[model samples]
Target: MTTIRVQQHAFDPGAEINSFCARNPTSGGVATFIGQMRDFRGPTRAEGETVAAMTLEYYPGMAERQLDDLVKQARERWPLDDVLIVHRHGPLVPGDAIVLVAAATAHRSEAFAACEFLMDWLKTQAPFWKKEATSDGATWVEAQASDDARAAKWKK
Candidate 1:
């Protein structure tokens, strides 16, 4: 089973994960990743404007098609019993959950790896464009080299 959703409202990651596990009761392990909004900029920068909010934008059908392809790639690489991806768009504040990914399989290794793979792809390859609001002003977030490096590691 594979489930995917893109919405503008807030979601409870704990509830979503629990439901995923319940629906795949026979799977031995389930790994999940929840991505949330943050207040800071880069990892090493000690001084700069902090992010107050963010807005994600995308074309509905295009985003869904990209997500489906990502799931299909994950399934081909791992023997997964189920997968779930929930991503939010629109205006969001710091500490809001932006995305959730879960992978269930017969072993911990596959579950963990697949979950990580999905997250990496989502971070770099997903179709959504984001704009961050800071004390200075709102700016469109650009793709970072570090994110591209992480996603590239999974490529054959």
Candidate 2:
């Protein structure tokens, strides 16, 4: 099964991973990645060294569709028993979990690779925009070429 959602509430990584692995007797390993809100800043926010809060914005339909596609691609490439992706939107503080990717497979290698692949693709391709509230003010962070480059490596 594949599950994807954009929620305002926080998620429990253990529960999410366990739900994905449940009823999958063939899965020998499960890998999970959780992304957190960090104190990231650009030139505009250099004056503010800390991220007080952040709000994630997304085109509801588009974001879900893009994530669904990535999950499907991962399933095709690996013998995955299950995959679950959940990304939270709305205001978040530093250290809050922003996203979660969990994958279950028969082998550890496949599980690990698929988890990494899902996270990389989501970082580059997902249509979510983030605005941070810093000491200076709120600003939208631009996407970097490095993120695209990281995702491109999965194609090879």
* Top model number, lDDT: 1
Best by TM-score: 1
lDDT of 2 by residue, 45-155 (tens): 465467789999988899999999999999889998888899999889888889999888889999999999999999998999999887789989889898888899999
TM-scores, all candidates, are 0.96, 0.90
lDDT by residue (17-100, candidate 1, tens digit) is: 889999999999999999998887767437756899999998789888888899999999999999999999999998999999
Question: CA lDDT of each candidate?
Answer: 0.92, 0.87
Quote the RMSD, in angstroms, for model 2: 2.6
Indicate the TM-score of model 1: 0.96
Pairs of residues at least 3 apart in sequence or in different chains that clash in candidate 2: none
